[model samples]
Target: MRRTDPEGHGPVRFGPPLPADGLPVLPELSAVLAAAAPLGGSEPVGGGPALLEAACAYWARRGLSAGPERVVAAPGAPSLLLALTAALGGDVLVPRPCAAWWAPYARLLGRPVFHVGTPAECGGVPDPYALLETVRRVRDEGGDPRLLVLSVADDPTATVAPPEAVHEAVEAAVGEGLHVVSDETWRDTVHAPHDTVLIGPAEMLPERVTVVTDLAGALLPPGWPAAVARFPEGEIADDLHARVLDVLTALGARVAAPVAAAAGYALTEPEPVTTRVAATVRLHARVAAAAHAAVVPSGALARPPRAGRHLYVDLGPLRTALGAHGVGDAQDLEEFLTARLGLPAPGGHRFGDDLGALRVRLSTGSLLAGTDTELEECLSSPSPVELPYTQRALITVKSVFDDLRDDAQRWEPPR
Candidate 1:
């Protein structure tokens, strides 16, 4: 998992495929643990009252109003998603090129999954028109597409859906009677708070939408693995909440007591946590922008990252040049980059993109490689990306694209 850039060429990651350097360690975490009561001998079927109350306050800050009774917690968002998929008991509609875990989780629960293309602006919510068509096509073929999962602030593509688009997509899904799971894990990670617009489906269609938040992404440390869901007030919501708890109970799943204590404190968004989150967002945006600048003019097609820690790269433009080197598809592209540039990125095929698309998800997180003290300095620095450590990572990324572009320009097809 550790691939050295060789001669300080770039950064390397060895953990869960997320930005590692900027992982914030909350100062309050230890105090929260110290104050927490000993774990009871029995596990709670769902999130305890304290955690649920904190979750409600977290959502309220973003304009969604809910009480603790409507909130349910799980070990993490993925676990909650699994329980929800099983409880809902029908086909699932997901965006083409979504978070890597969604499709696989649905399959594990034995639910059929259909993909709808995303709007040009983002990768989480499906394209409104395509969503309706896909739903109809599935139902016509006797596949009951009953759930639509999306992220208002998306992953892989790193673009936030416009408020208008969120409204349209939710309207379409609700009109078709699909229960929507809106993943807002990255909502608090918006790079530019003022420039980005995020409207959760729960805000628009509370009756039919369940908002899932992963605290690890924006608040807590990634290793903690805590998440909560806000359900709309209704009999169906009540029943689904109970079913999810039952499933979690069967699986012997519960967020660790200490982690749950941290979650409660983090969800309240204390000033220190907010400051750290904002700093992390700014760091990612700068590094990703630097990487984007290097890739776009070099014949790769990529959307300028607007939020989160990634950029979606399409290498179709270099197909001829790549094909000359036996790199004509997504898998080939992934291997070629890792072998040639010492960079490792997940191919689009893993996210339900076409195998031949030559697309890859590039994470800027690795740009944050260094000791904790160095990373903290980078976060606090007004020009973090300009620091030697961070600058070298960016330069290495730019150099890879520069070489690729040169090769493409000089390449001549074989007879």
Candidate 2:
């Protein structure tokens, strides 16, 4: 019953799909793009207030003190983060196994990024005790620790910080006077509404935090670039916002007039698109649940996912059995699954997990398609019997474990 790895013919998608909702609405300046089509004619300057205002309103509605002036629109979150790192110009701290972009973002700017281990329950926010120690260790090494960037509802692990955990992390940062940048790119895709608390980081520490979000993750039709960072209140925030605008101007990072119109519309009216995104969340929960059920001991290595749209399966317990299958580590397991089960999950190495440890992220979103019709159908179906792709994925993963158990028995010495 040895599981044979399935060969991958092309790219396998297992992440949130950008909603295919129609073009966003922009009533006032619909003529901006057509008129400025010639190498930037008028283009409506000042970073587009309607766009920023919409972003601010969205955040404020979420209980964040995101004033319109504090809203800084950029092409996307990564660019704005790079600019902020440059302007702040000090030591930055991030949790280990973060999104692949964080390391490169720091490397490109020649900024040092210190990685601290997160709690076993989550992956984005660092363990509070470790946070304190890391801060001391960094400053002791002669680097001024000024900012802490955390991704609530993290990308790789797909876990969200509990409200109390969020408060705890911020309290530690406050003690050290650290400015916090919370990336909420995946906030809209939480698997369970009540399981995740959507309090912006600014709510936890207003004067010390900035929340960065973009239409890239949850909203449908993300071709256009438009993102907003809700900065802290006060003169410092005013200065930072101005600096962001200056950098955007220098880099020509304005969200095109058409995209801004669309993004503004989406930000203001997100119910329809959000309903579309929820389908992915439901799919993740179902697939994860099936995988958990398939485990021989049911919870031996698989823990229930707390939030987000992915599952982090630990293989430490099955290491010896997996080794005999020629899967020695996370990479081997990833390859085995992709080749045999037709799953293309990223290995632990991608997220800074221990190389030798057997842990990999399983994104259940592979069931998604580019079309709204398919997405709509997936959303409406509840029972695994309804969606064939999602059901097949669950079965394939379950087959892996069934093979693992059978293989263990075969490898055992005769009694």
Candidate 3:
């Protein structure tokens, strides 16, 4: 029952997990690099013409009508978000327990942030009723809450916002005249392709929404930073697009020529790229489900993952037991898990959740370990978790939970 030392010799360093590598590299990358066509001049601030066309085509595939003129590309989603916030200057409203980076970016821009709690079914968008309430409250306090940021298919919680929730939140935000920024980076990574019911705010209220997507999430290789934004059509969209470009140009932020070419090709949704994305979706879903199952027996509550590479775990049910071991808050729980399991599970507080909540975001990407060939083989197998590399990772995760639960049952705090 003694606490394990995270830095001790026996601890397992689960990760700091990188994004999975089972997806195939785009074949167009070689040709694009060889041609070296885009390297000569600076791309337009919004994006180069070829990249914009590909982005338009990408959105078209998703059932949203877009033109090349409406698309803007940036080095990555975060940079795009920074530019967007600066361009649409105002206080930001985000769901409590949102992607870890959202509030931080708002703070960096010196904008006040209001965190509204999410609905029970999802983690990205705020609860519909709560959204209006938070906005009113912030405005009453003399704050200009003009921007609402969200992810339709969320990251830390790994759940997609249901269609009804999306509609209600959008209706509420639009009513308040708050411009919406929907980060749809993980929309393509849904585990069950048929189960995806994402109705982006852009589709629901196009004129009021700006859609941002990170290609690195599903298509491009890790470290290849590229993302695109689809602004709503018309004069307002044009103005925002211009402002975003001006900011990007000032920052000297442009996606590299070779990377832009690779991005353009992937955005075309080539068959190979789509197939690889499907494989990743399947692999991550299975691994995350296994991780979820492993922790549940220890009294951890987790939503079954629907997309992306994370699982949000709440140890509140085990609070009494955890508290006996001096793990009373989110920070304590995070440190305890890291020490015992060597897992880099960040506490919910980092994502704007209450510090006292016993929640942590668990990244499941480490489960896809081994060389690319081995990972690709695992992805192809009917039972991926049974493969040696994956199985070992799952087993380690389960064993940690088992040990924690066993220790919890045996330990008693001194009166």
Candidate 4:
């Protein structure tokens, strides 16, 4: 289960990308890029006027009013976040099992990162009580806790935080004089938009929260490397936006010109982009549910998949069986499951969770997509979960967990 790339070829990536989603670029996106490629020129740092305006429209739809001057765009969310972290300095606080890539940016700035435990209901926002206590403890120990990063629609664990939970967490953070960064990357990918109550911190505390969305989570492919951030508008935002722009300028983190054009178009939410995103959400929703059904039936614990393309399964209930198979911790479980299931399953350790916990994030993207042709078929199929190729993939997942269930029954000692 060892994965290695040759040295001196390229730098290794450190982040939460659960392998690439192998789906082809939407034909509409490709057309936009092709047309925009010819008018290529460097995009201004932050973003061009058009891109920023489109970003405003996007945010406006989400019940957050933002002006073009208050938005920023970068090649990726990590870059925008890094710039944000640099611009607003101090120790960073993140949920215990935050996005795999979150805490690293704070460390890049020599800022201490403290992991706060999440509430039982969700994995994105920290438990409100724990957040208050952690902030107090950090300050008492001379750690300047100034930033809190959370997600309403989270990765690894695909559950969306309830609006009440988000409100309490935001209140706890801002009450302590800390700013919030709400990563809404997966907001548009909600499996059941009507059933979920997602409230970004920005909606509650406009002046203190910054919203970041990576288009890869829905509108664009990952390789395109486009994301946008919205800062709250006020007199203070002028300085904050300029500081972030300065950081982007120094880091050369501008979105490529063609990417800017495509992003601007995507942000406008045209029929094709909207339709593709809707279908993709539906596709992932079906596969994620099937994956969850597979794991939970084997006595594994998992939050229901409400958003995004993955499920976070805690196999602690099957630890005896897994340990019998020499899978004692998250790392070993990651390797074992990936090797056995033939998918890219990443351990919870990658997301700052305890290494001893037998937890992993299973991506539906690779599970349902064995070939490009099959991907297209599933994407268009009326009942994708029942489609031949998709059903085969689901069977493969179910078989692995069924084996684990059998092993658990045989391996665990009777009371």
Residue pair clashes in candidate 4:
none
Per-residue C-alpha lDDT of model 3 across residues 27-82, encoded as one tens digit per residue: 56656655766575556666899999999988998889898878889888888999
Q: Indicate the TM-score of model 3.
A: 0.91
C-alpha lDDT (0 to 100) for residue 96 of candidate 3: 79
**Candidate 1 to native Cα RMSD, angstroms:** 5.8
Per-candidate TM equals: 0.92, 0.82, 0.91, 0.94
Candidates by TM-score, descending order: 4, 1, 3, 2
User: TM-score of predicted model 2?
Assistant: 0.82
Candidate 2: Cα lDDT at 284: 57
Instruction: Give every collision pair in model 3.
Output: none
Tens-digit per-residue lDDT, 1-415, candidate 2:
1111112312233322322222232232234444444554222433477877888778767877565677777766777887777667787788876765555566567777777778877777888888899888888778787878888788677677777777888889879888888888778767688755756577777888888876766653455566778888888878877776776667677666666665676677555545555655566566556655665352237556655556667777676678898987666877876787675666665555656767776766553443555555666777742466656667677777777777766776788
Best by lDDT: 4
Give the least accurate 10-residue stretch of model 4, judged by summed lDDT: 1-10
Candidate 3: where is the Cα deviation over 4 Å? Answer: 1-42, 411-415
Report lDDT (Cα) of residue 142, candidate 2. Answer: 82
Model 2 sits at a Cα RMSD from the real structure of 6.7
Output the lDDT of residue 346, model 1.
69
RMSD of each: 5.8, 6.7, 5.6, 4.2
Off by over 4 Å in 1: 1-21, 34-43, 412-415
